[model samples]
Target: MPDLKDLNSIYLIVAFVVPGLIATFVRAQFINGRIDKMTDTVLGYLVITLIYYGFSIPVISWILTFEQGLLKTALWWGLTIVGPACFGLLLGVAAQHGWLRWMAKKLGLRVVHGTPSSWDWQFANCYAARFVMVTLTDGSSIAGIFGTASFASTDPTERDIYIQEVLDVDANGIWNYRSEPSGILILAKEIRAVEFMKEL
Candidate 1:
């Protein structure tokens, strides 16, 4: 029930939307942030679409000022897609590595929608050297020193963590083990909190 213009607009929207989603995924994976939430994904796509236009418009106009004709039109359209995608990829990588995150925090851009932005990558990056206390939703807890290869997930409902040289804690909230248990795997969905251990 739509006309050619409507369909063309939909296609144009998809062109920006797909690349934006990919860029968001790339950055989220890099930072170990959950990307499966529908609201987060939809908001990311919309924001990226706006960013595409925000970046493309000025560059296209600047380029058009240098040339005029059908060739200029072709150049404008081509640059609109290619330039933004390349820039977005670089931006995403920077964000994943915590550089952009640090800058955002420094600029007071840390919280969004009443929630502080916390990435699992921050935990994964620092957990190797410290002891971790993983408390589960079922009231069971495990404490351990994680190996360097242990990892975290980007999915909130489905994350997995590995801990090596696990220490056993008694019923009274005291560690009772002088020996390590087997390596443990903790699922993020089952976990309630991860408490970092102070230096012993």
Candidate 2:
């Protein structure tokens, strides 16, 4: 092992560690997971880096065979930086769409989903706007529009919601726009259930 103060050791760290961090960060942007802990994140980066390197060994070997030249430098750059970035993007997309999971299922392997919870999945996939009726634990229901402006908490533990354009639900179940409140923020603890209805 090289000394920490040595220039070669520093270069080795930069060549390997930076790419892994970049890939992990890129993957996190597309996938939802409980990665709040520092230790867990660091460990994940290291693990991902190792796995990436393992898979990229063939390419690394091929690059090493080239004599020192501009092409060799470019290939080295691809191995160190561009390669990992592209790998992260493709990996994240594959995981996000369950392509990897689907394939793993064929092999009878146990695998977990990328999303933290169903709440994130629902809000993420529900692109079209609709009338949302939120029932509270206190037995009260608030009706509003779950449009582009509305928000759902992505935090796995926090199942909060924000409904834009409050509505009045009459006895006949007709929804009318409220004149007072613009939107309502419902906390996770208070929420009992949520119903989405198509606009009439």
In terms of lDDT, the best-performing candidate is 2
Candidate 1 yields a Cα-based lDDT of 0.64
Give per-model TM-scores.
0.56, 0.73
- CA error at residue 198 for candidate 1, angstroms: 5.0
In angstroms, the error of model 1 at 46 is: 4.2
The residue pairs found clashing in candidate 2 are none
Candidates' C-alpha lDDT: 0.64, 0.80
TM-score of 2: 0.73
Q: Write the per-residue lDDT of candidate 1 for residues 41-103, one digit (tens) a residue.
A: 766676876776686777756776865788786776566456555755676567545576677
Model 1 misplaced stretches (Cα beyond 4 Å): 1-7, 14-16, 33-46, 61-85, 90-128, 136-141, 167-182, 188-192, 198-200
